[model samples]
Target: MQSVDVAYAEEWKMDHGIMVPLHFLTPRYDMDIIPVNINCQGPPLTPLNRVWEFGKALRRACDSVPEKIAVIGTGGISHWPATPNSVKIVEEWDRDYLDKWLANDKEALLAYTDEDTLKDAGQGGFEIRTLTAISGLCEGKKGDLWFYEPIPIFSVGCTVGVMEV
Candidate 1:
Protein backbone atom coordinates (compact mmCIF):
# COMPACT_ATOMS: atom_id res chain seq x y z
CA MET A 1 0.00 0.00 0.00
CA GLN A 2 1.15 3.57 -0.69
CA SER A 3 2.10 5.72 2.28
CA VAL A 4 -0.49 8.37 3.02
CA ASP A 5 -1.32 10.66 5.91
CA VAL A 6 -4.31 9.67 7.97
CA ALA A 7 -5.36 12.29 10.48
CA TYR A 8 -8.35 13.05 12.61
CA ALA A 9 -9.77 16.55 12.67
CA GLU A 10 -11.57 17.45 15.88
CA GLU A 11 -13.54 20.11 14.14
CA TRP A 12 -14.64 19.72 10.54
CA LYS A 13 -16.61 22.22 8.51
CA MET A 14 -19.04 20.20 6.46
CA ASP A 15 -19.18 20.79 2.71
CA HIS A 16 -21.93 19.85 0.31
CA GLY A 17 -20.16 16.58 -0.40
CA ILE A 18 -20.57 15.63 3.24
CA MET A 19 -23.66 17.59 4.13
CA VAL A 20 -26.07 16.58 1.37
CA PRO A 21 -25.89 12.87 2.11
CA LEU A 22 -26.01 13.41 5.82
CA HIS A 23 -29.04 15.58 5.36
CA PHE A 24 -30.93 12.83 3.63
CA LEU A 25 -29.50 9.67 5.16
CA THR A 26 -29.15 10.80 8.72
CA PRO A 27 -31.62 13.62 8.72
CA ARG A 28 -31.74 13.63 12.49
CA TYR A 29 -27.92 14.05 12.56
CA ASP A 30 -27.86 11.51 15.37
CA MET A 31 -25.22 9.11 14.16
CA ASP A 32 -21.47 9.46 14.36
CA ILE A 33 -19.59 10.10 11.12
CA ILE A 34 -16.01 9.50 10.18
CA PRO A 35 -15.73 11.51 7.02
CA VAL A 36 -13.13 10.40 4.52
CA ASN A 37 -12.47 12.86 1.73
CA ILE A 38 -10.48 11.73 -1.30
CA ASN A 39 -8.55 14.29 -3.37
CA CYS A 40 -10.93 14.04 -6.27
CA GLN A 41 -11.35 17.80 -6.69
CA GLY A 42 -7.89 18.79 -8.01
CA PRO A 43 -4.83 17.63 -9.86
CA PRO A 44 -2.20 15.31 -8.41
CA LEU A 45 -5.36 13.45 -7.54
CA THR A 46 -5.03 10.07 -5.88
CA PRO A 47 -4.44 7.44 -8.53
CA LEU A 48 -7.26 4.95 -9.05
CA ASN A 49 -5.07 1.99 -8.08
CA ARG A 50 -3.96 3.65 -4.86
CA VAL A 51 -7.56 4.53 -4.09
CA TRP A 52 -8.44 0.83 -4.46
CA GLU A 53 -5.74 -0.18 -2.03
CA PHE A 54 -6.86 2.47 0.38
CA GLY A 55 -10.37 1.12 0.19
CA LYS A 56 -9.09 -2.35 0.99
CA ALA A 57 -7.23 -0.98 3.96
CA LEU A 58 -10.34 0.81 5.04
CA ARG A 59 -12.23 -2.47 4.97
CA ARG A 60 -9.59 -4.13 7.14
CA ALA A 61 -9.72 -1.29 9.62
CA CYS A 62 -13.48 -1.34 9.82
CA ASP A 63 -13.51 -5.09 10.26
CA SER A 64 -11.11 -4.88 13.20
CA VAL A 65 -13.58 -2.81 15.11
CA PRO A 66 -16.68 -4.11 16.85
CA GLU A 67 -18.84 -1.09 16.17
CA LYS A 68 -21.27 -1.27 13.27
CA ILE A 69 -20.14 0.83 10.37
CA ALA A 70 -21.98 2.29 7.44
CA VAL A 71 -19.96 3.34 4.43
CA ILE A 72 -21.65 5.77 2.13
CA GLY A 73 -19.93 6.97 -1.03
CA THR A 74 -21.50 10.06 -2.52
CA GLY A 75 -20.57 11.74 -5.81
CA GLY A 76 -21.68 12.69 -9.29
CA ILE A 77 -21.46 10.20 -12.15
CA SER A 78 -21.12 12.17 -15.43
CA HIS A 79 -22.07 15.80 -15.13
CA TRP A 80 -19.81 18.77 -15.70
CA PRO A 81 -20.00 20.99 -12.68
CA ALA A 82 -19.19 24.74 -12.71
CA THR A 83 -18.34 24.55 -16.41
CA PRO A 84 -20.20 25.78 -19.48
CA ASN A 85 -21.25 22.20 -20.09
CA SER A 86 -22.79 21.99 -16.67
CA VAL A 87 -26.01 19.96 -16.50
CA LYS A 88 -24.96 17.79 -19.40
CA ILE A 89 -25.56 14.18 -18.39
CA VAL A 90 -23.67 11.47 -20.22
CA GLU A 91 -26.24 8.77 -19.51
CA GLU A 92 -24.39 6.17 -21.50
CA TRP A 93 -21.12 6.76 -19.70
CA ASP A 94 -22.83 6.82 -16.31
CA ARG A 95 -24.67 3.61 -17.01
CA ASP A 96 -21.54 1.87 -18.20
CA TYR A 97 -19.65 2.92 -15.13
CA LEU A 98 -22.53 1.83 -12.95
CA ASP A 99 -22.50 -1.57 -14.58
CA LYS A 100 -18.88 -2.12 -13.62
CA TRP A 101 -19.51 -0.76 -10.16
CA LEU A 102 -22.46 -3.05 -9.53
CA ALA A 103 -20.41 -6.04 -10.53
CA ASN A 104 -17.42 -4.93 -8.43
CA ASP A 105 -15.25 -5.28 -11.52
CA LYS A 106 -11.89 -4.14 -10.17
CA GLU A 107 -10.09 -4.25 -13.50
CA ALA A 108 -12.68 -2.20 -15.33
CA LEU A 109 -13.11 0.30 -12.52
CA LEU A 110 -9.40 0.89 -11.96
CA ALA A 111 -8.78 1.00 -15.70
CA TYR A 112 -10.17 4.52 -15.91
CA THR A 113 -7.39 7.07 -16.31
CA ASP A 114 -7.88 10.62 -15.12
CA GLU A 115 -7.48 11.97 -18.65
CA ASP A 116 -10.04 9.50 -19.94
CA THR A 117 -12.47 10.32 -17.14
CA LEU A 118 -12.14 14.04 -17.77
CA LYS A 119 -12.66 13.64 -21.50
CA ASP A 120 -15.35 10.99 -21.43
CA ALA A 121 -17.16 11.71 -18.18
CA GLY A 122 -16.04 15.29 -17.47
CA GLN A 123 -14.25 16.73 -14.42
CA GLY A 124 -16.91 15.65 -11.99
CA GLY A 125 -16.24 12.10 -13.08
CA PHE A 126 -13.12 12.27 -10.96
CA GLU A 127 -15.46 11.94 -8.02
CA ILE A 128 -15.72 8.31 -9.02
CA ARG A 129 -12.79 7.68 -6.71
CA THR A 130 -15.32 7.32 -3.93
CA LEU A 131 -17.26 4.69 -5.82
CA THR A 132 -14.09 2.87 -6.79
CA ALA A 133 -13.05 2.86 -3.17
CA ILE A 134 -16.34 1.23 -2.23
CA SER A 135 -15.66 -1.43 -4.83
CA GLY A 136 -12.37 -2.11 -3.08
CA LEU A 137 -14.01 -2.22 0.30
CA CYS A 138 -16.43 -4.84 -0.89
CA GLU A 139 -13.89 -6.62 -3.10
CA GLY A 140 -15.72 -9.78 -4.13
CA LYS A 141 -19.12 -8.58 -3.05
CA LYS A 142 -21.61 -7.49 -5.70
CA GLY A 143 -23.64 -4.33 -5.25
CA ASP A 144 -27.19 -3.37 -6.15
CA LEU A 145 -28.23 -0.03 -7.58
CA TRP A 146 -31.36 1.07 -5.81
CA PHE A 147 -31.76 4.35 -7.61
CA TYR A 148 -30.33 6.29 -10.55
CA GLU A 149 -31.54 9.29 -12.47
CA PRO A 150 -30.09 12.25 -14.31
CA ILE A 151 -31.46 15.28 -12.62
CA PRO A 152 -30.29 18.23 -14.71
CA ILE A 153 -31.43 20.80 -12.17
CA PHE A 154 -29.34 19.02 -9.57
CA SER A 155 -26.44 18.87 -12.03
CA VAL A 156 -25.70 15.21 -11.43
CA GLY A 157 -26.56 11.67 -12.31
CA CYS A 158 -27.91 11.02 -8.84
CA THR A 159 -27.29 7.46 -7.68
CA VAL A 160 -27.78 5.29 -4.61
CA GLY A 161 -26.40 1.80 -4.16
CA VAL A 162 -25.46 -0.76 -1.56
CA MET A 163 -22.72 -3.38 -1.60
CA GLU A 164 -23.35 -6.87 -0.27
CA VAL A 165 -20.64 -7.16 2.31
Candidate 2:
Protein backbone atom coordinates (compact mmCIF):
# COMPACT_ATOMS: atom_id res chain seq x y z
CA MET A 1 0.00 0.00 0.00
CA GLN A 2 1.13 3.55 -0.71
CA SER A 3 0.61 6.73 1.26
CA VAL A 4 -2.20 8.98 0.14
CA ASP A 5 0.20 11.75 -0.83
CA VAL A 6 2.29 9.46 -3.00
CA ALA A 7 -0.81 7.96 -4.57
CA TYR A 8 -2.39 11.36 -5.04
CA ALA A 9 0.81 12.78 -6.58
CA GLU A 10 0.94 9.90 -9.03
CA GLU A 11 -2.70 10.51 -9.83
CA TRP A 12 -2.05 14.22 -10.32
CA LYS A 13 0.61 13.52 -12.90
CA MET A 14 -1.93 11.51 -14.92
CA ASP A 15 -3.87 14.74 -15.52
CA HIS A 16 -0.82 16.18 -17.23
CA GLY A 17 -0.61 13.40 -19.83
CA ILE A 18 1.36 10.81 -17.94
CA MET A 19 0.50 7.16 -17.49
CA VAL A 20 -1.76 6.76 -14.51
CA PRO A 21 -0.54 4.58 -11.68
CA LEU A 22 -1.88 1.05 -11.81
CA HIS A 23 -3.72 1.41 -8.52
CA PHE A 24 -5.34 4.77 -9.04
CA LEU A 25 -9.08 4.56 -8.50
CA THR A 26 -10.22 6.10 -11.77
CA PRO A 27 -12.94 5.00 -14.14
CA ARG A 28 -10.57 2.55 -15.75
CA TYR A 29 -10.10 0.94 -12.40
CA ASP A 30 -13.81 0.37 -11.92
CA MET A 31 -14.07 3.14 -9.36
CA ASP A 32 -15.98 6.37 -9.88
CA ILE A 33 -15.20 8.69 -6.97
CA ILE A 34 -13.54 11.34 -9.06
CA PRO A 35 -12.17 14.42 -7.34
CA VAL A 36 -13.97 17.59 -8.28
CA ASN A 37 -12.08 20.89 -8.35
CA ILE A 38 -13.97 22.04 -5.26
CA ASN A 39 -12.45 19.15 -3.34
CA CYS A 40 -8.96 19.90 -4.62
CA GLN A 41 -8.55 22.94 -2.32
CA GLY A 42 -5.53 23.96 -4.36
CA PRO A 43 -4.63 27.14 -6.22
CA PRO A 44 -6.36 25.84 -9.35
CA LEU A 45 -9.74 25.45 -7.69
CA THR A 46 -11.46 28.52 -9.08
CA PRO A 47 -15.08 27.44 -9.26
CA LEU A 48 -16.41 28.82 -12.54
CA ASN A 49 -13.06 28.66 -14.26
CA ARG A 50 -12.52 25.08 -13.24
CA VAL A 51 -15.98 24.14 -14.33
CA TRP A 52 -15.25 25.62 -17.76
CA GLU A 53 -12.00 23.73 -17.95
CA PHE A 54 -13.74 20.48 -17.11
CA GLY A 55 -16.35 21.29 -19.71
CA LYS A 56 -13.71 21.73 -22.36
CA ALA A 57 -11.90 18.55 -21.40
CA LEU A 58 -15.08 16.52 -21.43
CA ARG A 59 -16.08 17.87 -24.83
CA ARG A 60 -12.68 17.15 -26.26
CA ALA A 61 -12.55 13.65 -24.83
CA CYS A 62 -16.01 12.75 -26.03
CA ASP A 63 -15.33 14.11 -29.50
CA SER A 64 -12.03 12.24 -29.66
CA VAL A 65 -13.67 8.94 -28.75
CA PRO A 66 -15.77 7.25 -31.40
CA GLU A 67 -17.95 5.23 -29.06
CA LYS A 68 -21.52 6.07 -28.23
CA ILE A 69 -21.77 7.75 -24.85
CA ALA A 70 -24.53 6.94 -22.42
CA VAL A 71 -25.21 9.62 -19.82
CA ILE A 72 -27.02 8.16 -16.82
CA GLY A 73 -28.22 10.13 -13.79
CA THR A 74 -29.40 8.51 -10.56
CA GLY A 75 -31.17 9.52 -7.35
CA GLY A 76 -34.06 11.66 -6.01
CA ILE A 77 -37.85 11.16 -5.76
CA SER A 78 -37.54 10.48 -2.06
CA HIS A 79 -39.45 11.99 0.84
CA TRP A 80 -38.89 10.93 4.42
CA PRO A 81 -42.33 11.70 5.69
CA ALA A 82 -42.96 11.38 9.41
CA THR A 83 -45.89 9.09 8.80
CA PRO A 84 -45.73 6.22 6.35
CA ASN A 85 -48.74 6.73 4.14
CA SER A 86 -47.81 4.27 1.43
CA VAL A 87 -44.86 2.30 0.16
CA LYS A 88 -44.43 4.72 -2.71
CA ILE A 89 -44.25 8.46 -2.17
CA VAL A 90 -43.93 10.93 -4.99
CA GLU A 91 -41.58 13.83 -4.46
CA GLU A 92 -42.23 16.99 -6.45
CA TRP A 93 -38.99 18.53 -5.20
CA ASP A 94 -37.06 15.66 -6.72
CA ARG A 95 -38.88 16.11 -10.01
CA ASP A 96 -37.94 19.78 -9.96
CA TYR A 97 -34.34 18.81 -9.42
CA LEU A 98 -34.48 16.48 -12.40
CA ASP A 99 -36.10 19.25 -14.45
CA LYS A 100 -33.26 21.62 -13.72
CA TRP A 101 -30.76 18.90 -14.48
CA LEU A 102 -32.27 18.18 -17.88
CA ALA A 103 -32.26 21.93 -18.53
CA ASN A 104 -28.44 21.89 -18.06
CA ASP A 105 -28.42 24.68 -15.52
CA LYS A 106 -25.11 24.73 -13.63
CA GLU A 107 -26.56 26.60 -10.68
CA ALA A 108 -29.11 23.88 -10.20
CA LEU A 109 -26.37 21.27 -10.35
CA LEU A 110 -24.63 22.49 -7.22
CA ALA A 111 -27.80 22.81 -5.15
CA TYR A 112 -28.68 19.11 -4.91
CA THR A 113 -26.36 18.08 -2.13
CA ASP A 114 -27.48 16.49 1.07
CA GLU A 115 -26.07 13.29 2.53
CA ASP A 116 -29.45 12.39 3.88
CA THR A 117 -31.05 12.94 0.53
CA LEU A 118 -28.49 10.71 -1.12
CA LYS A 119 -28.84 7.99 1.48
CA ASP A 120 -32.60 8.07 1.47
CA ALA A 121 -32.60 7.90 -2.29
CA GLY A 122 -30.22 4.89 -2.26
CA GLN A 123 -27.77 3.36 -4.77
CA GLY A 124 -28.88 5.32 -7.78
CA GLY A 125 -28.24 8.51 -5.83
CA PHE A 126 -24.56 7.85 -6.46
CA GLU A 127 -25.35 8.40 -10.11
CA ILE A 128 -25.85 12.17 -9.68
CA ARG A 129 -22.14 12.70 -10.15
CA THR A 130 -22.51 10.86 -13.44
CA LEU A 131 -25.05 13.52 -14.46
CA THR A 132 -22.65 16.24 -13.37
CA ALA A 133 -19.88 14.72 -15.47
CA ILE A 134 -22.15 14.38 -18.46
CA SER A 135 -23.30 17.97 -17.95
CA GLY A 136 -19.79 19.17 -18.58
CA LEU A 137 -19.91 17.52 -21.98
CA CYS A 138 -23.50 18.62 -22.58
CA GLU A 139 -23.37 22.14 -21.17
CA GLY A 140 -25.64 23.94 -23.60
CA LYS A 141 -27.69 21.10 -25.01
CA LYS A 142 -31.17 19.84 -24.29
CA GLY A 143 -31.29 16.56 -22.37
CA ASP A 144 -34.07 14.05 -22.11
CA LEU A 145 -34.59 11.88 -19.04
CA TRP A 146 -36.03 8.75 -20.53
CA PHE A 147 -36.22 6.63 -17.42
CA TYR A 148 -37.02 7.04 -13.75
CA GLU A 149 -37.56 3.90 -11.70
CA PRO A 150 -37.56 3.52 -7.96
CA ILE A 151 -36.77 0.08 -6.51
CA PRO A 152 -38.08 0.35 -2.99
CA ILE A 153 -36.84 -3.12 -2.12
CA PHE A 154 -33.29 -1.85 -2.52
CA SER A 155 -34.17 1.74 -1.58
CA VAL A 156 -32.68 2.91 -4.84
CA GLY A 157 -33.64 5.42 -7.51
CA CYS A 158 -32.48 4.94 -11.11
CA THR A 159 -32.64 7.30 -14.07
CA VAL A 160 -31.33 7.37 -17.61
CA GLY A 161 -30.83 10.55 -19.64
CA VAL A 162 -29.64 11.44 -23.10
CA MET A 163 -28.02 14.72 -24.18
CA GLU A 164 -28.75 16.18 -27.56
CA VAL A 165 -26.12 18.27 -29.21
Best by lDDT: 1
Scored against the true structure, residue 156 in model 2 reaches a CA lDDT of 34
Query: Candidate 2: which stretches are off by over 4 Å?
Result: 1-56, 65-90, 113-127
Tens digit per residue, CA lDDT, model 2, 34-100: 3322222223222433443455465675577787643332223453322253244344545665787
Model 2 gets an lDDT of 0.48
Compared with the true structure, what per-residue lDDT tens digits does model 1 show for residues 1-165? 334445577887878888999999899999998899888889989998888888888888899899999988878889799898898999999999999999999999999999999999899999999999999999999999999999998888899999999
Q: Estimate each model's TM-score.
A: 0.94, 0.49
Clashes of each: 0, 0
So what's the TM-score on candidate 1?
0.94
- Local accuracy by lDDT, each model: 0.90, 0.48
- Judge candidate 2 at residue 19 and give its lDDT: 26
